[model samples]
Target: MGVWGFLKTQFVVHLLIGFVFVISGLIINFLQLCTLPLWGANKQLYRRINCRLSYSLWSQLVMLLEWWSGTQCTLFTDQETVDHFGKEHVIIILNHNFEIDFLCGWTMCERFGVLGSSKVLAKKELLMVPLIGWTWYFLEIVFCKRKWEEDRDTVIQGLQNLRDYPEYMWFLLYCEGTRFTETKHKISMEVADKKGLARLKYHLLPRTRGFTTAVQCLRGTVSAVYDVTLNFRENKNPSLLGILYGKKYEADMCVRRFPLEEIPLDEKEAADWLHKLYQEKDALQERYFQEGTFPGPQILPPPPAMDSPKLPILGHPPPLTSNLVCNWYLRQRLPPLLILSFLGFMWTASFAVRRLIGVTEIERGSSYGNSEVKKRD
Candidate 1:
């Protein structure tokens, strides 16, 4: 094995990396707790603080994906979508086909400068998990139990709470409601057949209640729905473990933006619109599998990627102060420079440690479950 591959297989590296992730995450979680008192004083300020705090936690995975693994994402979308990204509230509809799909989505969010403000319609159990789950809890991510009766009021209120959100946010939803698997596909297709709906070969039939409810609750706040289809180019089986191993895979994502105004406002009509949208998503996946690319001219992801500082390591270091400037000038510039340097260094230090570390199931677990849609407790 090559030197990089050899280091990835080592254990001490993973432990130190995990220690940093777990410890720093706990610290950030505590910091989020400290922001609770500010909420009553200024709701918007509290949200702004949480958004930034959320980024420091979430970007580590993006760092691993981009810097350590060298994985890159190619976007297939019209220039209008590219132009509008990070400027408005959007609902991201993604297919749950691979473990790293969420990472890929977050990479896009980071590129667009909204990673700090990203939200999700996650299951409630996910909130109890460490790091990521805890981070989401503070970021005001809406949670569900998948039972419409029990979740209806709670889920609606959670989504409605975001209507007055002060920052641009991406609400990620996996309408498939579960990861794709051969058995699940068989069952999902069976449901589609029973309902007289067309079958989807690559994706499962969408669960529409959550989608419709979210659109209805966030009507005045959300601007558009981003219908995203993600697929690997070389039939690679992507997993968090693979990333930890420093294996790279190119993710091709085709995004189609649909304005909320055009979607049918009526519940039944809205559900029908969602179903039709999924059918189109299925066709996109079908085409991708056949041709190895999405239909539109591929739009490369926005540049100046969220790359970690290379160890020797990681940023645009501030301009040096001339000796001619006195102690006052040094006081003004030194602290911020020192702070950025320390933060950037620790950031790379942690990830370089991960380069040596290994992955556990928990380290690699999905917000949703693996291989099935069964609830996590």
Candidate 2:
């Protein structure tokens, strides 16, 4: 193996990278906490700030997939569809088959210039996770307990909060709710049998509550539903750890955009719509297994390049200064220097507080002792 390849396999190198990620992520989370008070003053500005903060953490993983691991993500859609990607709000219904499926979705988000502000319908437990989860809380990403009775209101309210959001966002919904495993898939198919639904070979039965709720809540705010199907070449299964190990993989994504207006307004009808969509997604996956490609013609050339220019939308905003500054700082400075500074500041401040408090308590205890002794005398 080459020197760089040998180095990539080193456990210490991966640990160092993860250490950097955690420290930098904590700093960004701290910065996000500072924005909480700003929400009442200027909600849009607060949202904008958070978008950039989220990018700082999320882009690290994206870089791991795109640059470090050299994963190729090809979008199989027409030119016309590509133009509208980053301009409007979208609800992305993606297949959750691989461990790194979310990363592939982020890859598309990065391409469309929405990586910073992308949201997901995630499990509630993730909200407690240190970096990524804490950041999602600020971004207003919806979380559910997988219970329709409780999650219905929480999901709707969360979606409603994004009505006046300033920047464009792609809200991802992994309707399958969990990563695919053969045992889980079999259990899901058994549930499908009970429901009299069609069996899906490549996917588990999608939970319609999340999908229908999102569509119902954000009917006017979101423009289209991007039915995204993802497949990895060579490696049928890809894990996040594998990406960290610099294992190269090719990801193929087929996106079909449907306008929100076309979807039925009634919740039950909408649920049925999602079921049909998943069926189509299953068919698409079957085709991939057979032909080694998706149904549509490829928009970009083979082995997609990371630097390709994104499709231009009709009313897309001109490049903003904030985005440029945020990208530059995150890419150039945040990892090493800022991590050390933040950690140093935190350690120093904590030590000083503890010492001051300890001294104060000791002094007070001494005074109490003296007073008791004098009274006894």
Q: TM-score: which candidate is best?
A: 1
Instruction: Please list the residue runs of candidate 1 whose C-alpha ends up more than 4 Å from where it truly belongs after superposition.
Output: 304-377
In the range 24-119, model 1's lDDT, one tens digit per residue, is: 567779999999999899999999888877776676667778876788899999998898898899999999888788899988888887878899
Alpha-carbon TM-score of each model against the true structure: 0.82, 0.80
Q: Which runs in model 2 stand beyond 4 Å of their true positions?
A: 301-377
How many clashing residue pairs are found in candidate 2? 0
Question: After TM-score superposition, what is the CA distance of residue 300 in candidate 1 from its true location, in Å?
Answer: 1.4
What does the lDDT come to for candidate 2? 0.75
Best by lDDT: 1
Question: Against the hidden true structure, what lDDT does model 1 obtain?
Answer: 0.78
- Candidate 2 scores a C-alpha RMSD against the true structure in Å of 14.2
Q: For each predicted model, how many residue pairs clash, with residues at least 3 apart or on different chains?
A: 5, 0
Candidate 1: residue 346 lDDT (0-100): 54
What is the lDDT, from 0 to 100, of the residue 332 in candidate 2? 65
